[model samples]
Target chain A: MNNRDPENSPVIRLSDICFSYPGGPEVLDHLHLNVYPGERIGILAPNGSGKTTLFHIIMGLLFPQAGTIEIFGEPVRTEKDFRDVRKNIGLLFQDADDQLFSPTVLEDVAFGPLNMGKAKQEALAISRQTLSFLGLSGFEDRITFKLSGGEKKLVSLATVLAMSPRVLLLDEPLTGLDQDTQGKLVSILSEIDLTYMMISHDIDFLEATAEKIYTMKDGKIMVDEGLYIHRHKHAHMLGNMPHRHE
Target chain B: MLDEPFASGNSVIHRLDPRFRVMAAIVYSFVVAIVYRFPALGLALGASLTMIGLAGLAPGRVFYRLLLVNGFVALFWVILPLTAGGEIVYQLGPLDIQKRGIVLAAQITLKSNAILMALIALTATMSFATLGHAMNQLKFPEKLVYLLLLTYRYIFVIEQEYKKILRAIKIRGFSPGTSLHCYKTYAYVIGMLFVRASARAERVYQAMRCRGFAGKFYSLAEFDSSRRNYVFTALMTLTAAGILYLEYLPK
Candidate 1:
């Protein structure tokens, strides 16, 4: 449904990216991906398929041996170059516990805005607003760890949203959520206006939330056309009877 | 599993600002620590008891905490009475119990209980996070405040990790025994916990950076002192002065 002209450049671009851990096999081997503005991209990959590694590299948390990274049409090279990148690009970690490190919910949610140099009052307002948007009103003074699993998940998302990032990199946002929470997350993700690149192994979840889907294999991602399920004739044990098989 | 169970309350002590609580706890603890005379010690202990009563803490829980402290103080009672050389009070089997030693041990017990009770009544009524924020507002070093807050935040997570590791071990048919294998396995478990903790710390740091954290921690906690806080201050001042007066009283 996007009617933007083709002349518009991608918001994030990674070309010829190669990364490997010390004393380990290559995790990302010359992978390439491009994400345009307002694009909701979903990536599907199994464990240890370099999906997380790719996002880390994109955010400059992990440096690739060889890659040219561009964000907002500028080449990112040094640590100074990545400062603006992290400020504008919010990376939601896989584990909610790792994100909500503050003692209270409001503190954790306000942390991002405060770090972005907003005044204390402004940050508090942003945190409250973000929590209210996530249907977490009146959770400001609640203990962070005392929250239920689903509530922690939403608060973690609030922490990222309070930064008002132009782009979001969500890592396995639906991993351990209950069915009800999963449904809530799907609706929330669909309603937000920001562009995001989410990686998860849940194919149905990807299809529901992402406009374009990609699958990862051998440290590389390829566009996923679709899964095909068709009928075929097969012989059963009962006197060569014909049956439909998938 | 780690929790601040006593932090939630609506008593007068709990309603007092945490900044006041922290400061009062510090001053009162110092006064009780230095006082040696029995009369002043008794007054201080009475004041601590009053504070505890005002806080409305559960008597059973408070007594349990005192029992734990006295368990450690029991050691002092055992050693000090025999070791200290003073006028002999009692004669045991080839051992003399000194009067000076008994008096010293009694003083220590009173001081320890008094300080501990005051701390529980003041600081324990507020969550650790509030205490940290109050310290920050009181001009404590920013780095120290951050350390306290971050430690309080992750202590629960680390405890959960510990439990998870223990459960994994139990699921593998491992049981605690006084054997070399059991000792080695326990050692390895602790080593694994440390390794996991360091790795988690790295990820937490990166997550903080992702949110644009740059060595700055801005707190949104606001501590407003009401008339109750002033009354608390006045009471604390009067208690301290009374204890001092009793200590320096003409004998």
Candidate 2:
């Protein structure tokens, strides 16, 4: 193999990736992208823009109808192929409830580490540290079902964060969070050096968090922007600019 | 028991290897099952209960919880001693109370207590994940282990669904009066529950598949074997072997 260190290559690459739900129009079509380490790219679209479908493809949670996804320079198709890659990539599901299916905050955080073959003590240690990092220390033993929406979102991230992934996929991290929580979340994401990809309709949050933007419409890449929003018809509907910085 | 504290804080029993604890439980269970003599059974019970106490769980609360399950066990075990003829202790009208009745009750209590105490020690000292790891170490069927893993994962999802179902039923003022159609409605409700559970199972399987779950499961919790582990295993093996020998003797 005439090449340099593969590990030093781009962490994520999609070559002509296309997918569709069974019997549906193509949700993602002929999409190509390369994500280097420490990149924060946001997929901006309205509902049904195939954003989540694209995420499922990248996570290897859904097989694309065509095309290929490589995480950390390893092609993922079979389950085993992705297992090692997923260890370094954390996926936050759009619905916090779906993402959080553990009985307690501690157990939730411990899942990924436990899956990664960490000892219970080590898993517990990682969980405690992540909880503290996310400012959810005292709530370790609290029942997850009793947590509010914002807490659920934060704890969900903490679960992935505990795994210590190098790549993070966040599907709408700010949907239901209040302004204060949203601010905190942005700061938290800003601080993590991991390569990040997000899918959201929040324009202001996209501006605050994303260093680059890619738009998908009707199963194809439509636009790529790396700036504040221009005068678009749906731009005013995001309800994000009301976010407070003071 | 209901108030039993799951093993917290650092102690030998809590810190011991998961593998030993699991093996101890199995060997202890086998020994308890075969023991017919009251003395051997009682000794086993005492030793196991002591371990439970050592694990930092309250003995009173454990006993109370055991008492709760005794009703269910007694319903089955009391049959032979009650109807069988034996040395008469006392008589209540036509009914003859005998030594056999007391012996049967003692046997059931001893065996149940021994088995339960072992379980208490194991559970009190280990979290569910450790128990899972321990189970795998003991060569538990992979199917059963994965079932446990799935059950662990989906329990919260099921609870959320249950709450939603409860809320919907409450809002609709669902009350049933005994009638021909009420039973039909209840049957329909049960059928719906099974269908929903089945669908959820399918979805979970797909999700796991997506995540690259092969036949083997990965747990973040690891078992670190130390000199403590060796000592713990030896102590448990000795106790179990002692119990088995005592139980194996002729009645």
**Among all candidates shown, the one with the greatest lDDT:** 1
Docking class of 2: incorrect
> Model 2, DockQ value?
0.20
Writing each residue's lDDT as its tens digit, candidate 2 over A168-231 gives 8888888889999999898998888888999888888888888778787667765444433654
Enumerate the candidates' DockQ scores in order: 0.83, 0.20
Q: What would the per-residue lDDT of candidate 1 be over residues B70-134, giving only the tens digit for each residue?
A: 99999989999999888998999999999888999999999999999999999999998999999
Task: Summarize candidate 2's per-residue lDDT along B72-149 as a digit string, tens digits.
Answer: 778745565557669988777877777787787778888888898888787657755567667866778867876785
Candidate-wise lDDT, in order: 0.90, 0.75
Residue pairs of candidate 1 with colliding backbone atoms: none
Model 2 — TM-score against the truth? 0.71
Q: What TM-score would every model get versus the actual structure? A: 0.94, 0.71
Q: How many pairs of residues collide in model 1? A: 0
TM-score of chain B of each: 0.96, 0.87
> C-alpha displacement of A148 in model 1, angstroms?
1.7
